[model samples]
Structures are given as C-alpha cells and as structure tokens.
Target: MGLLPLNYRRPSYVAGSPRTMSDDQISVGSGGSGGSGSANGSNPPKPTKLATVVAGIPDALGFDRIIDGGTCPPCTTRDFMNYLIYVERSAENLQFFMWYRDYVKRFNEAKTSDIALAPEWTQAMEDDAVTRIQREQADKIRKETKTPAIAIFNGTDFEKRREVPKAPGSDTNPFSSPPQTPNDRDGSSDYVSTGEQSYRAQANEAFAAAGVKAPFTIQPFRKEMDRVIATYITDGAPRQLNLSDREQKVVLHALAYTTHPSALREVNKLAESTLRRQAHPNFIRWSICNGNTARVIFARVLGGSLIVVSTAIALALTLSSLGRGYRAVAAIGWVLGIATLIAAWKGMCVVLHGMHHHHVRPWELFVSEEDADDLGKRSFDSFGSANSYEEEPWVVRYHKRNLIRKIFDREVWIQEPALRQIQDTIFLQSMLCALLIAGLLTAIFVASPKGNFF
Candidate 1:
C-alpha cells in the first residue's frame, strides 16, 4: 500500500511573508514581491496599492477626508500627537496582520504534515522495527593515546560526547600574554542585581569582553521614529500605511475604542469588511480626527464667527457710549474687550476632531539606532550597521529583539488637563449662547410704548 497520498497538493505561500498554523506567529520573509507574482503564475496583481489601503478603511469617523489632499486645517500640538499615534498604530497593526494570516497558513500546512507521515510509519511498525526505533546508540570511544592523550570523536556517541584535549598543539603557548590595558567591566545596569550572580551574567560579560554589544540595552532609533512620524503630518492628515492583517484590525479597533483594553486580541477576518464599514474614529483627544468631526468643525466655525461679530459690535457701541453717562459701563467694556483680544491672540484656537494621526515612512520602524549619531547616517533600505549601513545586518533577529525591548519600555509624555479644559470652553460658549437667547426671549416687552399706540 502507498504510505501517503500522492495527490496531496502542498499549499503555496506568499513569499517573504510566511505564517504558521495554530499559533498567530508570523515571520515575514524576503517579502511577497515575487510570491505575489508566483501565486498568480506571474500574472499582474488585481491593482492593490496604498490608495486601496486607504480606501479599504471604513470612513465612519471621516478620517479619510483629513488625509485627502486639500488645504490642510491649521495644525496644532494635538495633531502632532495624534499623527504619531497613527503612524505607530499603522506599523503595529500592519505587521500583526501579516503575522496572523501567515501563521494560519503555516499552521494548516504543519497540521497536514504532522498526520501524513506519522500514521503510515506507526501502522507499518513490526516488532523488530519498533525495537530498532527505541534503541539508543552505543558510545564507541576509540581511545588512541598519543604523547599527550586527547580524546577523539567518532559518530558512535550521538547523544553524549565529552571532548578532551588529545595533546597541546605545537603552537600552543599556555600563558601567551595579557592585555596591556584593562577596561571597566561594569556599565549599563540592564538587569537588577539581587545578591548571587548567576552563570548568565558571566556568560554575558564573557560575550561582551569578546567585543559583543550588550543585549538588553538594545535601544530605539529615536530619529527614525521622529522622521516617520513627521511624514504623517505633511498634509496634516494620516496617510494610510502598509500594515499586516492583525495590525490593521488592532489599529482599526484602537481608532474606535476609547482606551487600550488589552493587546494581541483575536479578531475575525470574515467580518472585517463589515466591521470597517463604519467610519473609523480618529479622535484621541483634540488632535486626532475621525469621520465624525464634521459637527466639531461646524461648531467651531460658528463660534469663531460669533466672537468676531461680538467684538465688532462691542467696539461700535463703545464709541457711542463714550459720549454719554454710560462711560462707566464703557470703561468696563473696554477692559473686557482688551482681555478678550489678548485671550484671542494668545490662547484661542479651533480644535479639529476628525483627523488621521498616523504617519508611516518607508524606513521608519525598521531602524534600530545604536546611538543618536547613527540615526542621522544609517541607510533605511535595510537593517544595516550603525557604523556602516551599506548592508543589512546578517544578525537580523538579535538586533530586532533589542529594538523591540527599547520601544516597549519607552515612556510617553502625558498632556496637562488644563490645556484640554481650555478647548472644552467651546462647549461652555455654546451653552452661554443658548441661555442668553432664552433669557432675552423670556423678558416680556410691555409692548414698546411708541410702537403700540393702543
């Protein structure tokens, strides 16, 4: 009987981006560059591009409009903050989405592979075959003693092989030399010391002594992040970036959700289109805008117009009041006018609500700065050395892990509440206008004497 089905078609995967099944672990390879081509037998793609990425997002929050090319709204500090968040979220979500889909695919392949060869071999086992499978290899040590006895290795010992020096080489000089200069072994307290030193520390120091960079201290390339974030503000709107599937969902949710609940949450791919159909909210305070910011904009515009009109009217009336007994009232009015003018000059601003806060530069998140100086010089094409960015680091995993740790533990600046309350004054103004209208209407005009000649 045939051991396994020959009709099995191994699933083809997107090149550069591979995923595992069962777990959401994803590993991006050289990229889907040729794989996308190969998958469709070298045919052209269905025209997916960055524009499609932007369009695919549901505009419930009107975030798409902000990113639209037009006269950008007046920029503010909050906009910068939101833009940074947007870029960060874009990178994060896109990466995860790539990871998740890739993982599921790999998982399917793995699951299929696990059963295919296992069942056939298990059922075909005879008593002798079973015994052979279970048997352990015997250690065959050929003890050849030379002038200085050194143990030699043959393949006889598969599990355990203890190598001993056969004899000192002719070139061996035991105490050759010591370094002329000794350097400080201690710096960068990466890990907390809690009494006894573990073997890990020795290993780390030994590794470092041999000129290896410290592992835990792998820090962030701040300049790259800043550059990437800055790009998102060009039109003062978030340009949708390339993100993985999981990342897309997370950011989409983050855009909608008020607070971060938890991370690494499972999201449904099937319902993604439906979920994204609603306009995604961009507001995370005053800076971020979503599709829903129309009301906010209109309100602000009307309020600003009102303030201008009010100032003009007060100025005109004050000129008249200067000629009469209303001079005391005019004095007070002038003081109020000056205060309002100063406030308008210094503190007044219209806050835009629906805005895209994410920015993504091609080389933004990929960089890991060894130092601040390295940030200004490195080529972002690939993960190159801080010293020379001519080529991507062969040690990608090691460098990347360090980069992630640095970013993960990074601190963020929390905005003061006072600034926020200042913006909220718009709401107060709206209420004041409503109350004034009501009070004036309520005061009964006893019928203007001259008008009602009753």
Candidate 2:
C-alpha cells in the first residue's frame, strides 16, 4: 500500500552540532581589596566572551527527499499534467500540484503499514481517507467562492473590479460580492469576487460598473496546457527521473494507462518493464475484487447460466401449452435466474443484502476519496494497530438493492464501463428470453386449436 513499499529505507539520524564555549576570552575582575591587584586601581572593561553558535541546522525528521517537481521524477508538474491533468482537467488546478506531491510522499510511506496487508480496509483507514478528501474538497470550494470572474489590468498593472457586461448566453458570475471597506487581513478597499468567471463581457461589465477608464482590459488565467503538452510530446529523449525500481513500477502502472498522449509517449520512451506493459486499467480494476471474491463471481456466472437457460425453456413450454402451465417450475427458475444475474454482474446477491463472503463490485472494493483520505490519516496516527471495519457501526459491507433500487441506482455504476458491459449483457439475455417465450406463445395461439381457447 505504501508508495515505495519495495525500496523505501529509513534514513539514519545524525545528531545536531553540540554547543561549545569560546576559549580565547576571559572575564577581568575588579582589583581585590584595592592594594595587591593592579598598577592602576581603575576597573578595566570585562573581556567579552562570544558564544560560538551554529545556525541552519538540517531537518532530521523530514523525509530524505521531498516529493515534488524539485525532487521526484514522475511527480514533476509536466508529468503530473500528462498523467492526471489532461484526462480530467477540471479536477485540478495549480493547487493540485501540492496535493499530488503530498499524496506521493504518503503513498511511499504506506508500505510500512500493517493495514497494507489486511484483507479488507479498516474503519480507521476509511475515516482517514474520507476526512482528507472532504477537507480538500472544502478548501477547493472556499477558493472558488473567493476569486472573481475577471481581473482587470491597466496595461498589465492590475486595476479595480467591475460588473460584467450583459451578454446573450453568458453565465452568472458566482464570484460577485458586495463592496466592502479595506480590512487588515485582506487589505482591499473594494468588494471582490471569489470565483474565476472566464468570460470577456463579464469583465467589461465589472469595469463599467466601477466606471473604470478605457485604457484597462480584462484577462484570464494564462493557461499553458497546450504548450506543456507540446513540449512533453517533442521531448523524445528527456532525462528520466532518478527513481528506485519499485517507485518506477508504481508510477508506470498508473501512468501507462492514462488517456493523455504525453503519458503514453513517456511510457514509450522509457525502457519496457513487464509491469508497465501489463498495467491495463481493467486489469488494475480487477484487483479490486480479490482472488477469493473473483471465484465467487465466476461461480455465480456458472450457476446463473443454467438457471437462466432452464427458465427460458420452462416459460416457453408453458406459453406453448396455452396456460396449462408448470407455474411452480417457472417461478423457481425465474427467481434463481434473476438472483444469478444480480450476483454475477451487479456483484450483489438478492438473497443476502448485507453479508460478507460474497462477490463485490470493483467500486465497492475500493474506498471513496473521502474514505481513502481517512485511511491515510491512520498511516500516521496508529501505533502499529488499526481499527477494523467491523468495529465501525457506520461501515456497510454490501450493496443493498431490490429490482427497483437497482433501476434507480443504475446511473451510479454508469461510469464504470466494464461493469456497464456486464449489466448490458445480462439485460440483453433477459430480453432474448422474454422474446423467445412470447414467440412460442404467439405461434401456439396462431395454430388454430388454441384459438378456440382464446
């Protein structure tokens, strides 16, 4: 679980410089009893004794290396953009660079944790992960609420705020706020917007509202996404970062599957490693369902196939016999078939909603961002022991749903394409079975002898 699990080593502590007294200087004493001490009875100034002091002591408790563009190879701003930014640009801004660096440092440290070896994440881990995520999200929200839509500049020297000009198809500025007197903390004379509104008309309106002079114009944040992307693509043989083999593996596994072209190019530039080559997102996702759980899923699929096939045949036969039916057999078969479908694809058993020892969805296996942050906190807080999931009253072990719940919650799993495919396949099979039964019934009814019964 730790970032550099395979290669991280604790650095040796070197004691700080010991304090020492200067030997050259001595304190002069006043003439003792006036007669035997000095040629002159006047007291001389005491010899100054300067203390030898050492400054700029290195941080001993700090990590041997800071995880940032300055030290980490894979964590460079450019690489960060290539791997994480382009794929989900809106999720990050300049501030995310700091978070990413911290994440790298913590991930590297997690290798030493006993929680890493636990079969399932503990409640402490989930709490740690969730708390951090909520904090980050709140911080982001607070920041967005503070910045204005437009920043005016008087020939590059920033000027006062203004109301945005009314325009068709323009978004309302969320950053707009009432003007306020200058304060000690912020030191601003006028009202300021918190959100960054990225339109030109809004800037013009703000300027007009403030009655600013014509010489001023508004500008947006200087985006360097394309420029960085171009450089990343062009730099064919850029020097690789100095990373241990284990760090390299972890970094590559995450980067190798990114949608960004720059990331893919970097993967190509680096010498091929087995881990990198095999690091498909689906394969990584599969790991979320541990080995034992995967077997349970396969078992569901096997059992479900038989039930679904038998149900289809029984329903078809009942329909062909003109309602002189094997209703009990059909009901049992349908229930088993439905249960199997749910267990195999949804990874939730209809019979056992809140139980463990059942197949789970990939998303279910992984903790949410908030939970992950909470778990991460445990990495530092715990003294070699962590709180188990069972100890937490709030932690739910399984996804609970009836057919209706599944329908409503379908969108929850929509983002997961692999799971989506599984659902789609099961849906298609269900439809085919229904169609087969209908076709058999229609044929029997059309064949004259059943027409009299109708």
Candidate 3:
C-alpha cells in the first residue's frame, strides 16, 4: 500500500516518460499532482509517480511488481478495478478509462486509412436523425401499399413484426407423409433456421438481404460511442460519472463535431485523475481492512477474554488459600493474552503470522456467482480473452465451506517477501511485549499477600 515519494520520477525511456507517447496516449499529467496541460509546443508534461505506475512503468521500488513473482496477471490492477466496481460503486471512471485505451488503439490502427472517419452528433441531432429515418421508412411502406396508414404507436404492430418467421416446411399438414430430401437422408444440412439465429445475426441478415448499407456518415463504431455516452457521460444514466458541469459540457460539445478520441480528451483526463487520486488509494486501504482488520478484531476480543479469565482465576486462587505458586499458573494466560492484544493493536493476525498465510476475505468469498460471471464476460468483451479477468479458484472453494471452516481457512500464502518481513517484525515485537508484561504480572501475583507458598 506504500506510495512513491513526491519527488519520485520515472526514467527518460520509460513508458510514462514525456518522450515515449503523447500526453493523451498514456494519460501522462492526468493525475492530481500532474501538470496542467501538454500543449503550446511547450515541454511535455512530466508524468506523476501514480500516473507512471498506472501506465505500467516499473518504479525504482518494485512495489507494483506481481506478488507471486510472475507478472502476466497484474493482480493489483485487477483488484483495484474490481474494488471500484463492487465496493466503491464508482465503476464508470475505470470503465471510461479502459474504453479510452481501446479507443486510442483503434484510432491509431486506422489513422492512415481512407475509411477513418468520425461521426458527429449532439443529443438533439441524434433524436432528429432517428425521427427522420422513421418517417422516411413509413412513407416508403405507405407508397408500396397504396393505402392510407393508421398511426398506432401502441407497439403491438412492432412486436408482431419482430417475431421470427417459421421455416417453409414447418407448416406442412401433419397427417401427410413428409417428402425426403438430401438433408433428411443425411439427418443434417448446411442450412440453419432463422429461428435459431441470434437477434444480432438476424438483423445483419435482414440488412444484407435488403442490400441496405447505412450511410458512411453514420461512421464506424458510432453505436459504441453512443452507448458509451449514454452509459457514462449523459445525465441520469445508469452509471453517470461525477464530472463537473464544465467538463461534461466540453465533452458533449466536442462530440457535436467529431467522435474522434480527441473529443473525449478532457473527460479522460478528469476520469484518470479521479481514479489515481481517489479510487486507487481508497482501494488499497479497503483491501487492507478486508484482508486483516477482521482478524485483528477477532484477536482483540479473544485476547481481552483471556485476560479477564486469567485475572479472575488468580483472584479465586488467592481467596481459596491456594499457594502463591499456584497463582503463578495464571501467568500463562497473561502472556498469551498480552501478546495477542499487542499483535491486534498492530493490525497483525498472530495465527496468520505464524502460518505465513492469509485468509480469503469475506467480501471476496461471498461474491455472487452472477456477478463473477458478468464481470468475466465484460472483461472478455472489452479487453479480449488474453486479458479477461477471472475470479481466483480459491474464492469459489471458499464459498462452499461451512461457517466454522470458512472462519479458520488460511488458503492464501504471503508470497511477497516484503509482506513476510513485515509479519515477522510484528510477531517479534508482540512476543517481546508479551514477555515484558508476563514478567511484571507474575512478580505482582507471587509477591501479593494473598496465599502461602506451596
């Protein structure tokens, strides 16, 4: 969870360096500590430490390195995005950032092509276009029928029109003997029924059959851009982002002229800043709490209970006229209780420290199956199969365990050397504190004028 110092800087040839890519390409200078702009032929803006880390640049300290030593998965980034979506409920920023990355890649690939074109629209423009298209289609249908059309907008006709058409042979009389063809003889055919086609496939087939190509003005990826706007940029959207009015206006205005990635530059910068400054740090803190805080609380409660029981036993032993030596037996509980309490105060789980493993967090274990599947599908759709995110296998197994077994589970090893060192340091400190406390308490118990030596 440690962050880079304020003065930390990436090397000149690193991915986040000013010379590596444009400010917009890697989102350099888009964080809170980043410079204002990378314009006016001025020197390129220096990338902030957080920005560099996010851009996949390795820092001087390997804090961002993969914990298990292999680097393919980048678990920290995956966990950060998952936390934003599931815990913080601020997924739009990450979604927008990810979408922007893909957009940039596509834009670069097509930059030199003749088909590289941009769509332009405002809310009013889009609405008007849809209305015009509908009116034209209705006029064409009327002219073809040569009948006065009755306008019924109740959607009944629309639903009927959308129903899939039955196959030609399906409506034959059932009592008649069916004619055998090549397909029947083989029990298979190359032909696929329209009813079996997905809605998207059916729509594409309809358009192709009609020889109706949409106008080039519609632009490639126009539908995707509109979806992104509706889902993340527009007010009253399902996951509308927390953007400033000025920033929102800038984006909408830019879209009025072009759907190029440049149209989203300002909004992209703001989203990146929000993720780095707020969501990323908050995710780290939440991760720590989810991973260790519960264990600490359990330790504190058990430790306090032991301390109380130990004190009561020593008092009972004195009152019963038992020897002072017998009262010393309470020192065992005192030692363990104090050590556990000290460890808890340091946010260390004594059992996990000793075992060199951590428990699967409750949130991680209890994630709904639907959510996991949806996340996996979204990741695959957005980033492709190679980078698709999958829930850890241990998470599924953890969910199947009973309550008692779940509480005692320690399946995740502390793979990071730094984390192991930290745990060791905490354990050593707790033991020293326990010994000091036990010696003091034992001395008081043996010297008290409560019972004779046995």
Candidate 4:
C-alpha cells in the first residue's frame, strides 16, 4: 500500500463537449504560461497531470480490448499511444515485483526499431531545431563582426542561411520523409502517427473539451514509444512478457509448495539451466526404501545395542588384562561403537545401498517408492532432459578439484518438496558410510586384542 492518504479523483478529459477544439484554436504551447482563462476568475482550472491522465485512461478508453488482441483488430495510432502510456506508468510501479522489473528493464533496452511507430514530422521538433539555429546564428554574428553593428545592419541574411537539425528518422534516410511501408494483411499497418504534433492535436481537443489549459507538455519519448509499439506487435499486449515454455513451467511449478506470492515471485530470480545443473547431482542414485518406520526404528535399536554391548566387552578387557598400552585402541573402539548406534537410530545406510548385497529394504529405512518417483521426475525435468547430441561446454560443466568445494559450489537449491528427498538420499548415504566404517573398526579391535593378530 502507498503512504499517501486516499481521496476521490475524477477524469478531466470529457469527450464530445464544447471544450474540445482544433489545434489552430488552442493557444497553449510548450512555454508554460497562460491558460484559457475561465470567466469566474483570473486563475484557470488546473489541467490534469500526466500521472492522473494515465490512471484515468482506462475509464476514458477501454484498455482491456488492446491487451486482449484477438478481440480487436490490429492496433491503430491511438491504441499504440495508449499502450505506451500504460507501460510507462506500469514501470513506475515496479518496486513491488522483482521479476517484472527485470523483464521491463530488458524490454526497454532491447533493439526494437522495426516495430516502432514511424514518427511523422512535427512542428515542435522543427521549432526546437529553429531555436538552436537561431542561437548558433547569434554566436556566428558575434564572432564575424569585429566592431559593434551599425543601425543599418540587419540580421535577415543570417536568419535565411541558419540550418535546422533534421529529425532522427529523416537524418538517417536520404528521403525527405520515411518511406511508406505496405499495410499488414489485416489491413492495419503497425506504424502510426505519434509525433509531438499528433499528441498536441489530441491533447488540445481533450483539454479544450474539459475547459482547462494543458497540464503536461507533449514531447517526443522516442525510445519508450518504440518499445511500446514493438511489444504490442510481438507480444500482442504491452504488459505481456517474453518467457519461454521451460521458464514458464519453472516459474509455476518450482514454487508450488509455498503459499506466499513473494516466494513464487523468486521464480525468475535465476536462469532455468542453473536450477537444472543443481538438481541433477541430488538424484545420482534414485532408490526409495519401501521401509516401514517402526521396523527401521527397531532395526536401528537392535544394531545400536549390539555395537554398544561389544564396545563394553572390549573396554572391560582393556581395563583388566590389556593394560594402559591398549588405552588408545580402546578409546578408538568406544568412538566407533557410538557412531554405529547413531547410524542405526537414523535409518541411514553407509554401505552402497544400490549394490545387490548391500541394498536397504523398504523395511530397513523410512522411505517410500512414490516419494522417490516424484523426486526423480523433478530432478530429470530440471537437467536430464538436455539433448544427448549437444555437449555442454567444458567450462560450464567442469568439476572442482576439492571435494568440499565441489559439493558446496556447484549446488543451487530451492525450497521445495524435492528437498526432503535430498536429505533422505544424499544425507543418509553420507552418514551411513561414516557409521559403517566406525562399526567395522570397532569389530576389528574386539577381534585383535594383542595388536599383532593380523
């Protein structure tokens, strides 16, 4: 919500009224001075601001018809102009959405001259050029004359020779005017009149009808105007974004678990390829243990009890006959025995569970086939669907030298249901391996008391 207090506002541009007048009749120009003074007082009624005009346009003209392109034919000059105004206004409100902000930034910078509304020559731009020429002429006159000019010396000759800057469109092309392009198959060409003159004419009519002087200057916003027209031609709507099919899926499905719109808003924070690269390694061995929770807990308790019992027996032997010489070995045995108990308690298997003999049954660990399958699908869709024929560049797909760096650096994670699978599979495997090694060492110590029983 905005900080400002809310008050009621109304549209100023009333249509089909006595105030509407032709450009020749409208006296207000760029000079910011006098308005068509009202009879009631010397002060004229204030014209509507640009921001207010933008907000009120939907009420004046139906904005929905332009956005839903199929419902209407190709956009006209007025349609494109209104759409540009909408985008300019929308971009101002981008603080609330990061994805939209990024999209708008790219959309603004992208090359779009092809679809830009071909600007007709405007008297305003020419007048601006003439003003510049007049300034230059004054400078030249000052430089050329060594002495002060006599009363007979008139500057009429300099005025005739002064050069005006050409329009951006005409400067590039040799033709005096932009070449007329063929109309689209739909019979409406994409190019429309949007020069300063066109807006001045429209604004004059609207402001006159409303019985107020113009509030805003009608100036050329060439680049922004171009983007608006280009977007309408390509996307069929000014606000519509240019996202791919894969990106759309990621945006929608990646944040499905979270209820917050802010969480979903992060969908465009990274590239799709980056997400896929991170998801691939977590599914190296996708096997869901069809293990019952109770059975796994029981097995863990039984395994832990056995290791502890054995460790106790070894400690007793070391204290009685093995002597202080075996103290280090006994300490190692105790550490190993305790780690094995932890492994059993957690339903994790350190030995390769996918191997035939070492495979953990569903009853051995707390995992379900359905959960594994769903995770596998998400993993595959994220990265595994790449074409086999095209290899990723070595620079992008290369592995790190350090094991710790490899795991931490290459991974990109999102908060999702698949994270649970990562914890169960990858995390469990690592812990189980640590427990198995510890348990094996403890057993060896129990078997070899003299330290020479190789």
Candidate 4 to native Cα RMSD, angstroms = 28.3
Q: Model 4: per-residue lDDT, tens digit, 1-454?
A: 1111122111222222112333333222121222221112211112111111122122212222222232221132222222222222222111112223333333233343422332222334334434554565577667657545531244454432332222133223243233332222223222234453443333333223222232222111222223322332122233333344233323222212111122223222222111111111111111122122443454456556655665676666654655444544544544444544444444433222223112222211233557545533432221112112123233233332244333222211222222233223433443455456665655665555553322
lDDT score of residue 147 within candidate 3: 40
Residues 1-454, candidate 1, lDDT per residue (tens digit)? Answer: 1111222111122122212222122222211122111113211112111111122111221322332322133222223222333332322222223333332233223322112211111112223332332331112232332312343333235212232213222124332221211111222111122321222233233223222222221111111211222222111213323334233323222212211111112222311211112112222232222112223333344455554554454344444423323222333333333333322332222222112112222223455545423543222211121222225342353345553343232222223232233234432343344445423322322111222211
Rank by lDDT (best first): 3, 4, 2, 1
Better model by lDDT: candidate 3 vs candidate 4: 3
Candidate 3, poorest ten consecutive residues by summed lDDT = 39-48
Query: What local distance difference test score does each model get?
Result: 0.26, 0.30, 0.51, 0.31
Ranked by TM-score from best down, the candidates are: 3, 2, 1, 4
| Candidate 3 lDDT by residue in tens digits, 48-134 | 223333322232112233221333221355555566655666666766676676665554444323223553234354355445546
Candidate 4 runs further than 4 Å off: 1-302, 315-347, 350-454
Residues forming the 10-long window of minimal summed lDDT in candidate 2: 214-223
Whichever of 1 and 2 has more TM-score, that candidate is 2
Candidate 2 residue-wise lDDT, 242-273, digit = tens: 23323333222322122112222222223111
Select the stronger candidate by TM-score from 1 and 4.
Answer: 1
Q: RMSD in angstroms, candidate 3?
A: 14.6
**Which is the leading candidate under TM-score?**
3
